[model samples]
Target: MSNGYGKKSNSPILASVLHGPRDLRLEIRSVSDPAPHELQIAIKRTGLCGSDVAYYKNFRNGDLQAVAPLSLGHESAGVVVAMGESVQGFHIGQRVALEVGVPCDDCRTCQRGRYNLCAKMRFRSSAKSVPHYQGCLQERINHPAKWCHKIPSHVSLDSAALLEPLSVAIHAVRRSFIEQGDTVVVYGAGTVGLLVAAMAKLSGATTVLISDVDSGRVEYALHNGFATKGYINTKTSPLTELSDKLMAAKETAVDVVDIACADQPDAEGADVTFDCTGKEICIQAGLYTTRPGGQLVMVGMGTPIQTLPVSAAHLREIDIIGIFRYANTYATGIKILSSGVLPCLDNMVTHRFQGLDAVPKAFEVAGRTVDHEGSLVLKVVIET
Candidate 1:
């Protein structure tokens, strides 16, 4: 029997699959038609997030192991090529960014509006459950219509691909409840770190400071204006020393500290601390850095089990909050990208690649590069 589209071919489309650690192979597979209430998209652009890299490098993330062959990308944007029956509000050639996770709506967590924690969530490229959901690295994808968010005409597909991570930052900002005139510190100049700083600024932060071990990223942040005070280079220095240096340089104690790096530091005196890095040290550092009664939001994904600074959190009355993917931030993220209110996008996209052939190269560049200025791409587009 012919496939859903009646398109017959000797060789199917190509996709990158993870067989094991550092084992990414391009394989061909038959394409399937979109199910009812789904849309088939011709993926145009994809971004190499840290999680994708981790899966590529280690073939495992936290408790997610690549027990079976799996596609390796989730941050993607595409154009609708076909729509299934009952799929409305989208058309052919419509550009879109997909929300990769689909939850069983009947679950208690899902019913509680915590869909990210739903026990039956099938996230693309995730191995937490069997019969893993494939990702959007291929030429065509069939995705649930509800999970797809249309992109504005002014916003490029590259920027749309960023919507996923941007939503993460937005959710983190919401969790922090950053008020107007708050002083914010982001501890990592990576994409998420940079995005957090930018979002915090948009959320009415009077001052936003970002720090990274890479001086290049610091310089990039300064040039891009993502941080009000530029990037803080925290190389080989203790947390206290770094905090002192930042305060001396910026002339104020950071009110909100967002830890975006994988390695955390003990940054004391911040009213709010966010651990976006998902590393044990960074988690501990977030707790240590938060002021009494402040909040620490954990956004990054770490090991299923890890040590934490319970004593510091309990003693200081720091509220530690966990963040799953995102709730309803796609439209907000698009607005932020389209309004041009956030000037960080210009500087954020430091690098660009053309065509699907360059995807592997893009991953290589993103993986090996340490300098944010030279390597940080606020958005990377893989064009046809």
Candidate 2:
């Protein structure tokens, strides 16, 4: 099997598999032919995200732990090599982006068009399921044809891999309940956060402010036109303890919010707020940043349980809405990326490493605030 074709091989192909905390092994794994209603793909690229990094570093993401060794990648794109007899509208050599989640069609959530909330969903590279589904860190794998989306010829396979995150941003923005000329504030300037800010502006928001702990990322959001202004919650004191750090983060969010909210001429606070960091601190601060009767969208995943300022939410009438993955947003992602509405969008993949052997290195780079050359690290891609 090659980067473009996943042919049946007599010998197993190289795969990046995670054994435990800080233990990622390059093993040889065999891939079977596509089952009925499936398509075998030659994975070209996989982009690592915060969840992937958490699994690699802690063997878990939030409360979910890996029960067995698994290949840890979900944001990926590939080429169709072989299609099952039952597969339709697909052919060999066609470019596609893998959605990576397979849901039970009969589930009520799925039937209601909220497949992402289906209890029986098997999301690749996630430990939420008992027997975890394998990810796309290998050379080739078979997936359900219904979950594989064809991409335009102009969309590079590398960028197609990012469609997963783009879908997430789209979902977040849609749930934000943004209105024309509204003041919107986004917390966290990561790839998804930046995308959310840009989409909010395009959705008719007059003021968009993005916040992050990293100064470089905040600046990137401003210079890239993702946000009208950026805010960095700088470190004021050396907080060595976890509790202290979290508290300091919370205070920073408050500071950022206080400053931005005071500038709002039309409302007491932002019309809508986004907690893209998923950190309890960000969530707590959003309660204060958002105006009365405004909405706060939770898009990121953090610790399973944390203390929140429920009093602030109740008194301010802030609607704290949570989003679990994305529901029915892949097509929107494809259209936005195909239209090229975002300039320097491809540059978001700041670091690209070659081969499955570099998978570990890619994760290491993804966790860093700055690259070896002092450049900001946004997204890291592994090319197989």
Candidate 3:
């Protein structure tokens, strides 16, 4: 079978490649048109995410090490430039949010309705898998039509590019099983954390409280209406001088939300909590802030191993659930974006760069907490 790239073009596609740690380069490569089951896409906008920034700076992310030249990017959206004869659902010129994790449908996980866990999953622009599945940082990609979801006309390519990360937030919220009036608390105010807070509100959370180490992000979350209350966590100690600081941060988040809803005694503690920062401290605080029988959903990725409060969890019967990359959430995310309910979603893209030429600087700005002017930048976009 042809690899989907059919006929060769005179001009080679310009792609961003990571040669090693802190080594990013632009290379020219050949690409063919779409094959039988594929659709050729002209990548328009790509979001620079934490994982992508990690791979660029350290040549690794958690367990996924970059052993060879790898192209880095996954959150993206584009328009179909061409399609194979057998492709039925998509047509040329249709705008779409590309789903990067393509799985083997015949696998056990896929058969069980968990394709994200498929053993043979192939992801684009990822170092997790060998022969590194090249990502959509280039001019074009011949992707499976089944993995592409059409974006509504109301949404811009930039918002569609963010659907991938939004999907993760959507999946996390879904896993929490939030009820109409449940109180929710989310740790971290980064891109994913912001989205998680927004999703919690849209999913019917009566009160959503967000906390982050960065004061700017916390203020942004509150000002943008993503969270009902925001707290800036300034403590870094594990124990020494930690008790009071941790309590203060927790109280600022939990107390304010509860105090506002003083009529409901049941709302004293958060019914659902999300650890979007994955730090041991945040995880510990999440456990403490959740009500008995409440659920703590882990969404962020951090150190592989960490200490857990087994006794506290056991006594309170707190359900601690882990969420991997999102599964079956693309459509819901697109719908949410199209609804225009999250008005601040567009403001998240604080910085933008054009074409592969600006990829290096884009990754640089994305990896930094503060920009050149010492201001916080929520998200960065690379437009091609």
TM-score of each: 0.85, 0.93, 0.92
* lDDT per residue as tens, model 3, 63-146: 889889988889999999877778897777899999999998998889887898887899987787788899888988889999
- TM-score: which candidate is best? 2
Q: Higher-lDDT candidate among 2 and 3? A: 2
Against the true structure, candidate 2 has what lDDT? 0.85
Pick the lDDT winner: 2
**Positional deviation of residue 331's Cα in model 1 after best superposition, in angstroms:** 1.9
Candidate 1 vs candidate 3: the TM-score winner is 3
lDDT of 2 at 94: 92
Model 2 alpha-carbon drift over 4 Å, by segment: 1-11, 235-266
C-alpha RMSD of each candidate structure in angstroms:
5.6, 3.0, 2.8
Query: How accurate locally is residue 79 in candidate 3, as Cα lDDT from 0 to 100?
Result: 95
